[model samples]
Target: MKILVVGGGTAGTIVANNLARRLTAETRSGKVQLTMLSASDRHMYQPGLLYVAFGQMTPDQLYRDQASLLEPTIDFHVDPVKKFMLDKKQVMTEAGKIHNYDILVIATGSRIVPDETPGLTEGAEFFYTEESAVKLYKRLREFQGGRVAVAIGVPHKCPVAPVELMFSLHDYFKARGIRDKVNLKYYYPIGRIHTIEAVAKWAKPEFDSLGIEYETLFNIKEVDAKNKIVKSEEGIDVEYDLLIVVPQHRGMEVIERDNLGEGGWIPTDRHSLAMKGHDNVYVVGDTTNLPVSKTGSAAHFQAEVLAENIASIIKIGAPVRDYDGKIYCFIEAGRDRATYSMFDYETPPDLKPPSKPMHWFKLSYNQMYWTSVRGLL
Candidate 1:
């Protein structure tokens, strides 16, 4: 059977590689043909971009050649998927090629939708993309310090990123000896700082101690860049010398145009990572409408389950595995320290509350990063 994976970023690369390794044995030889289609040759470690913005990581460390990372046996197509022809079980690329597959995995991740909000695309500076982050960093270094506002648009990837930016900016200004001259504000439409109640509870005390001003339920209506002001739906105008925006997010357009997403994200079985409507289609990572934070660790966990399920289907023609929705994130709070939380969906009747490890855990994890690369790749 032929399998087509329609992305080459974090989720796509991991799934494809895992399948290649599993199906390489003599017993499964010639039984599967794996192909990965992506729009660009650059594979970015997206999580590292946040550090890049803070001058913590260099640009070279954030990228790798997509072609070099894939297994030699797997076919890699560098092209954008134009549409999905479910009727024919084929995917059509912008280059006019149709790839037929017995099984299709829709791993196309979400994208930032700045244009969804009026004036945001035209006025505010976005830090979601590498190019934007670089530009913003340049502007930030030259900034003399004043009213700096970090606003989060609706439905953002890595929800904690805005808060991280807030903390880092606090540290940035304090180190520059202009903490007194700078006024920092964080605005979110959500009533709480984090979507997870437990995390929000843990973070509230930190915000209070840091003296960072925040406004909740404040939806930005427009950015009057010419006037250096952000107008909210609540009739509040926030003026800023520098505006850092986390733009709105949406599933890949190919998913929406082809009616693949249920609510701005592909609806997949939380346990199986399989698309609800299509038996042969599986989705992993940020594209899914799972009620969890979209992070790389979540993708890695989902990929592990997805690879096993695909192997089971090919080997025994049965979907025997399920995902547990397990995710762990290291939230950096600057000052060479970080906080972390581990969550699992398959807990027993009652489990203990989430635990927050000290900065030492994060420090040790940084060393483990090298080990992870060695083991996974």
Candidate 2:
């Protein structure tokens, strides 16, 4: 059997590593082959970007050589796939090589599209990437005192980020002794502060205690950079000194060009994690159009399920396991305290009070992320 995994993000890395460990005997006997193709030679710990924005971590600390993280039994390449001929069961890489596979895993992740919102890229600071995180940190450091407006865009990865950013900003300003001088305002597109009802309920009191002002039903339309104003589709205009935006996200261009899915998100089976209508093809991570929070936790859970099912199919001629939409996310509640949310498709997240131990655990996980990706956690 020939197995090809594309994209070397959290989901892809875990799936490949787990499969290599499970099918070690088959691979050694030349009965099965495992391969991975990625766009770059380095794999990034994406969650660390949030810490980067707060000056808690450096960009260099978030990366490891992609090959170093993969098992030696798996063949890995730095060439990115350009075309997905699903019907033919082949993918053509940028280096002009076509690889055939009995099974294919597509984990091409999402990307931030600030330019999609008019004037946003020029007017606001965002931290979805390393450069943007560094830039936001510098701007926060240089800021004296003014209205710091945080605007959120829809369908973005990490639903809890805006909330965490709010708390982090409050703590940062307080540490700088300018919390009283800086006015913090948050603008959310939905009717509530967050899409998840449980999260919204949990954060409202926290926001009030921190004196964070918020405006709901305020969808971002465009930014008037010259006038220092942001106009919303709901006929409200907000003026700001510094604008931090979450920005919109879309899947990779290759997925869009191939018409595999609208906005590059492949329609996936929620239970089996297979691409809709294609039995041999699977989807995971930010590339799936599942109604779940797009976080590394979700990717990890889905990867484990896929690795198990695929290995079972090869060994026993059948599959086992199903992805239950499970996700666990750590919420940084500022002031060296933190909490977590654990949920699945059948259950809503129950939040706990922030504590120092949870905060330390979150910090430890930042270093342990590499181990998790290696299928050790």
Clashes of each: 1, 0
Q: How far is 195's C-alpha from truth in model 2 (Å)?
A: 1.5
Task: Give per-model CA RMSD.
Answer: 3.1, 0.7
Best by TM-score: 2
**Candidate 1: where is the Cα deviation over 4 Å?**
26-28, 262-264, 346-377
Q: Compared with the true structure, what per-residue lDDT tens digits does model 2 show for residues 1-377?
A: 99999999999999999999999999999999999999999999998998999999999999999999999999999999999999999999999999999999999999999999999988999999999999999999999999999999877999999999999999999999999999999999999998888889989999999999999998899999988899898999999999999999999999999999999999999999999999999999999999988999999999999999999999998789989999999999885989999999999888898899999999999999999999989
Query: Using Cα atoms with residue i matched to residue i, what is each candidate's TM-score against the true structure?
Result: 0.91, 0.99
lDDT of 2 at 191: 94
Residue 208 of model 1 has an lDDT of 82
Residue 179, candidate 2: Cα error in Å is 0.8
